[model samples]
Each structure stands twice: as structure tokens, then as C-alpha cells.
Target: MSFVESRAAIAEALSTVEGVTGYPKRPTTWTPGDAIVLVEQIDHTLGVAWQVTWRIVLLLSGDEGVAIEQLDELLPLITDALQPLVYVDTATPEAVQTEGGDMTAVVILARSE
Candidate 1:
């Protein structure tokens, strides 16, 4: 699939997780609660196939402790939802300070070809 199509498919898969809001594109305004943001990280030609890497940011609005707890709860669900769609290479917790608020983000690296 093309990169755009792969991204859309990944978003669709992410939306299946309960209590998680999936964004195909970055939102102008952040959501109030838990959400997932899909970002295209890189794309390169691997032999005849094109490999696309996507950064799936799982975000929660709260302090580090609480947000980490919430993200921990959601991680398995997110991985399960993504398993059928893409190859999940890594999922790492990160502290992010956004204009909206202090947030915890689980940055997931996934790839598709």
C-alpha cells in the first residue's frame, strides 16, 4: 500500500481500542483526554519495496505518575489493535510538555511496506 493508505489503515486499527481517540492527522487543538496521534516519521526504498515508519504517539493529559499509569493500561490494548495492521518495533514512555498541558506520551514505532 501507499504511505497515505497505510497511515489511514493504521488509524482505523487504532480507533478500535476502547477509550482511545485516534487521529489520522495532527489536530489543531489537543483532545481533553487520552488520544493517539499518527505521524509519518520516515520512508525509504528497501530493495523493490518501500518501507514506511510511523510514530504513533499515545497521549494522556495529566502529571507523570497518573499519565504513566494510564498509558501503561492502554499500551497492551494499543499493541493488540495494531498487531494486525503493522509491525510494532518499539513503544517508549516520554514526558511531553505541550501548550495544552503536561502530558505523558508513549511513542510507538511501527512500520509497514
Candidate 2:
């Protein structure tokens, strides 16, 4: 269960954050809060060697600016946590917003050196 381990690592990195829940066994039944950040399992590339990118989604209950700020706050944390691994590319803002809140998903690419 590499994905599970990866998810766990991400959770451990984000432990200090006020409210964040990594891949929950029961997402439908439980949620962190209005400002929720979920670290999804790593999506792997099917080929000779396996490389992955973690999809970290942020659902904030504030204005778009607030959401972006939170996203910014998490990036370095994530980068630091995944020490051996690294961000594949610049975070594409795909930063979408909803009523009174914002949602941003950053796909971090990585390889084991």
C-alpha cells in the first residue's frame, strides 16, 4: 500500500495544520471542517519505472484570496515534507473558487533519487 504510506506521510507533514484530513477511510461519513485540505493518494505513471505526483486539494471556507494564501502556505510545507521527492512543475493555479470560498488542487510530481 504505497499510496497509503504516502498519504500517511503527507498527513504527518500536515499534522500541525489546524484542520486537514488525509484520505479518510470514510470520506462520505467524515470531514475536517469548512476549510478542509485533503491529500489524495499518489497517482502513478504506468511504465518501466513508477513515478508519481501527489494531488493535494484544498477546500477553504473563505474568499478566493484566503484560499490562495492557504495554498501558498502549504506548498513549502509539502515540498519540505517530501524531502526525497520533489515538485515536478510549478503549481498551476487551476485555483478555482466557489461561493464564499476557494478550491485549489496542486499535483506535485516526484521521483525517488
Q: Report lDDT (CA) for all predictions.
A: 0.74, 0.47
- In candidate 1, list every pair of residues with a backbone clash: none
Flag clash pairs in model 2. Answer: none
- Candidate 1 regions exceeding 4 Å error are 32-46
RMSD of 2: 5.0
Residues 1-113, candidate 1: write the lDDT tens digits: 66677777787788788877777787666653445545566555866766777888777756777777777788888889988878889988877778866767788898877
Candidate 2 lDDT tens digits, 1-113: 45556556654554545555444232443322222223433344665544545555434434557656766776676556546433534455454444434455443434431
**Leading candidate by lDDT:** 1
TM-score versus the correct structure, for each prediction? 0.84, 0.52
Question: lDDT of candidate 1?
Answer: 0.74
Q: Candidate 2 at 105: error in angstroms?
A: 5.0
